[model samples]
Target: MQEIIVSWSRRRADSPKTFTRRWKWTREDRARIEFYRTELAGCISSATFDAMLEGVNSESLLPFIFCYTVRLKDLDLGFVEAGLVARSWFCLGEGFENLRRVLGPGPRDEGFKYIEDEVEGEDTGYNDPDTEPDDIYVQEQFLTKQMPAGAEEEGALWFNVNIGAPGNYLPGLRGVIRLQSRSTIYQFPLTALSGWSAKYIAPLLFLPNLQELEVEGHATIGGLKDQFYYPLSIPLQLYKGLKSKVKRLSLVDGRMRVDDYDALAELTGNLEYLQIYHTYRYEELSPQEYASIASFFRKNNRSTLSLEEICINDIPGTDMVDVN
Candidate 1:
């Protein structure tokens, strides 16, 4: 198994004590590992975690995994989830996507069972398009506030274009890739992209040197346009010039619809590692769909879509299985 680097955070410095108080673990279990929230100048902000990622100098740093809690069903929970992705971190909500919205309605201090109940509820408000925020808007905001005009090319400011907010934040990118979450449900009407000007389009035009892209939320086949190139849903337009440059692609709380696979196969010619979560809603994929996708890759032998390893739990595959 690949060794993973685990990072944690708590609301306060004494949170370790709180964790201890909440759980009654065996002495053997307690002695096996070290778990503590990061300490950042008396606080651990999303910015703090960003700094940690930026300072690293490894071509293959183990992915940073986050373990935290938030209000269920609450908008803040969704926001925090989205924010984490924009900052280039990996998160697997303990209860999966359902945990977010459920916690939204309940108090944050509620018991574990209540939290579990929130996780079990059928509707966690993730797939709702109206609740999803815009990543460009958030990216724009981060740059205008922190970076100066001449410093953009100098790499002084960093923003993940896939985040919620305004702006592209790309011109100011300082060698950092921020990951962020997406709304569970969204509608990116590509047909609506006929009227936007370059000024509006410029920020979203990111660099071709990015290393990884961790996208969360509902990565439906047609929902990305609302946040990128709104009113127009031109596939591969968001990636534009950088399509072949991406090395790793991680999809969370998303689905790989038939059309989406075709589009992605077309854009990512050099893609190296592809990870999809909660694929097919735990239902088996149709044999036809699986074969079509597999055939697409076989035809494009040079494409990066040839995954080094595939990890799936309940999804189905074609009757013919040949990885080579």
Candidate 2:
């Protein structure tokens, strides 16, 4: 069996001054090599490419059979076999972006159908009843850069762009693109939280295969002293736009008004799990407000709601009490 072992990190003992040549691949490394060589090699070279194309029409299925990383210089036969893997996913340093640019235009130009349906006869187990959807990770900046030019036009807030458009390239090339549960973080700029959420977060709610979502708000361009703020209307708009597709939701490090609780109570009927941590800046909930929230969950108890988990925590200075 052919094997390729790569080790990018060096321990202090592996330094030049160590003088003793004790460096060797560990047992775990050998196992990884074997798995890649035997199982993954065949799957990538043939199966993954066909799956990606079929996924374009199947909204519930993800196109990627598996995700793996390879180096730019190492785009050998084996590397090309690993379809849909993000080049930046495994790069050792800063040059991955440049490599992405070099590789980007070719796939876009050939139009995702370049690979013929040679592997369609293979039993890739993509349709196994027990199979789970693949998880796609997308950074906030990456998501923003891909948004269509008039994405926010006509009060639509969010809608799917054409597959040929630069912003909508990923779905066309990779297929339905399901995101990983809890692992994928959807970040929005703290400086423009309301506007960003309106444009980007709205579309995410409609993703056909997305079941869980976690959103983090950070100030990439400013300091925390900036004290991010948004009206109750923003989150209300977000909750109103959410489809029944997502069963779990988490929001972190953002601010919403006290009245947003009414919106939350109205929106969470279809949710199975909900978590709000340090995301709201409202004053303490009045007795009536607390009762209203409790009533919403209590009313759903005898129904189909699998909403067994709910958490709400406020920032330190905010007088809001914890909700279970």
Candidate 3:
């Protein structure tokens, strides 16, 4: 599933323009079109995008736009795969920005550039060695610099230019594009983003109106420790920095410690619903952690306080509330 960011001022999901679609046709196909259209549209509109998706039957139409609600203003779906039903659902939105960063173009060399390694695929290791191509390719890469552009009301807000590679210099390539002004979601694969530190992830905090943030990957929550040390702390800080007005937040196969939960509780005081999944045993907290958790709930309790659902994948016991 993907994360969506919507504005607080945006119309409620129940509104017609925000969730419905209309198309006209002649009497011949009107009954069939209207029937399927109504049924498909209602299925999408009835629940939040993250809810379990109903099967899309229209293979003839552009599956992307056909399966999703076109009325949403802006959304941010993370680590989206190619050609899946959900991926098509994302393409329906106003924008679909890709955020996977690639190594910049290789270096510029006036002299003859030599190819040392064999190409990974195919019988021939060489790429027409005689023909001089337009671009140079670099192999070894280091993080030399990070240039952050100011938040623009339109166009891409952040872009990274990678400069060097192993053998040759290629033209720098730009990655991590953000089209913030448009009411659309950004989508990319989780594996595409292999090594991201707080520095790379921190600026997302500036997007105050972000309605939802979703990350998808196969790495189980317990495996997060293998990816980065102190994994939960930094993410917790970013969550805290997020504007409290955000209604929905999701982390998939990402580590969440008890303190992280406390941090989320602290930041999203107005949150109506919250969920966590694919994590380790959510054992009852030790006495100290329990106290801190109690403090968190007390401080962030909503007036309606409709639902507070904490789901841990590997926990052993029944639900227990620690008011101590």
Better of 1 and 3 by lDDT: 1
Which candidate leads the pack in TM-score? 3
264-294 per-residue lDDT for model 3 (tens digits):
4655554444444442333324545544554
lDDT of each: 0.31, 0.32, 0.30
- Candidate structures ordered by TM-score, highest first: 3, 1, 2
Tens-digit per-residue lDDT, 258-323, candidate 2: 444444445444566655565234223444444445445434432433324554552221233333
141, model 1: CA deviation in Å? 19
RMSD of each: 16.8, 17.0, 19.2
In model 2, which residue pairs have backbone atoms overlapping below 3 Å? 135-180, 136-179
Against the true structure, candidate 2 has what lDDT? 0.32
Which scores better on TM-score, 1 or 2?
Answer: 1
Locate the minimum summed-lDDT window of 10 residues in model 2: 75-84
Give me the runs in candidate 2 sitting further than 4 Å from their true place: 1-199, 218-242, 264-269, 279-308, 314-324
